[model samples]
Target: MKTEIIWMIIGMGAVTYIPRMLPFVLFRGKELPIFLQGVLKNVPFATLGALIFPGILLIQEDIWYGILGAGAAFLTAYLGANVIVVVLSSIAVLTLYSYFV
Candidate 1:
């Protein structure tokens, strides 16, 4: 059982390492196109929104909680605030909302 767990961990490590290593190895001497670079830069933001969107719609007790929090986050982010500020603003909005109602 211990051996199996060890082997599973090793296998998982290799599976993760290969995909990460391949990009560096294959792109060592080449530069990505300008359009591709721009798209890649935005990937994290797009992925964050994709991950958060569903949770916003699935709020159980009150849908307004999610909608208000999301709105606060969006407004903060739209004003050029960084990720921490965006998240903090959202939390503050929700806290106040919860306190009042």
Candidate 2:
């Protein structure tokens, strides 16, 4: 059993190492194509949209409430509200809306 666990740990380490090493090995001293760079620049937004959009639309309750809360949080953040204020304001708005309407 101890031997098995040791081998398992080594196997997992190799698996993790290969993924981390592959990108560096493949991209070393190489400039990405312009199109690829553009795609990469959009990747973060695409990832965020993919993650948030479905949750915003497909939850058990109405989508508008979640959207409104997100909008409020974003507005507050843009206005340079502190993180606590932004979080609290979002919660307050959502709670009030849920309670009253």
Candidate 3:
């Protein structure tokens, strides 16, 4: 609602958006090498793993619960499930484990 807040949001969005867009705009006409393309294709999964791995260790009560959730998520993702499905499957597995314990 405030002018300063509006400007800050726009500035923050631009800062994040520009880096993501810059690579595409700069490389639009160029063909990346096969190895480089393969590496780039795995970037999202690597980043997701990096972010999720830490939280996976922080579970209280039992470490096995966290390990089970991680295994389920990994299995679902490896089976070509969408990211949302991977996350939900992890949650479902953990919830059932908790209920049984």
Give the winner by TM-score: 3
Cα lDDT over the full model 3: 0.88
RMSD of 3: 3.6
Q: Rank the candidates by lDDT, best first.
A: 3, 1, 2
TM-score each candidate.
Answer: 0.61, 0.55, 0.62
For model 2, the run of ten residues with the poorest summed lDDT? 52-61
Candidate 3 segments whose C-alpha is farther than 4 A from its true place: 29-45, 59-63, 75-86
* lDDT value, residue 2 of candidate 1: 100
> Over the full model, what C-alpha lDDT does candidate 1 score relative to the true structure?
0.88
Model 1 TM-score, 2 decimals:
0.61
Q: Which RMSD values do the candidates have, in order?
A: 3.5, 4.5, 3.6
Candidate 1 per-residue lDDT, tens place, 1-101, comes to 69999999999999999998997788853389888888888999999889998888577568899889888988999999999999888989899999999
Instruction: State the lDDT at 15 in candidate 2.
Output: 100
lDDT of 1 at 36: 86
lDDT of 2 at 87: 91
What is candidate 1's CA lDDT for residue 17?
96
Ranking by TM-score: 3, 1, 2
Q: What lDDT tens digits, residue by residue, belong to model 3 across residues 1-101? A: 99999999999999999998999788863389988888888999999889888788667567898889889988999999999999999999889988999
Model 2 has an lDDT value of 0.84
Q: What's the alpha carbon RMSD for model 1? A: 3.5
Candidate 2 error regions (>4 Å): 1-25, 82-85
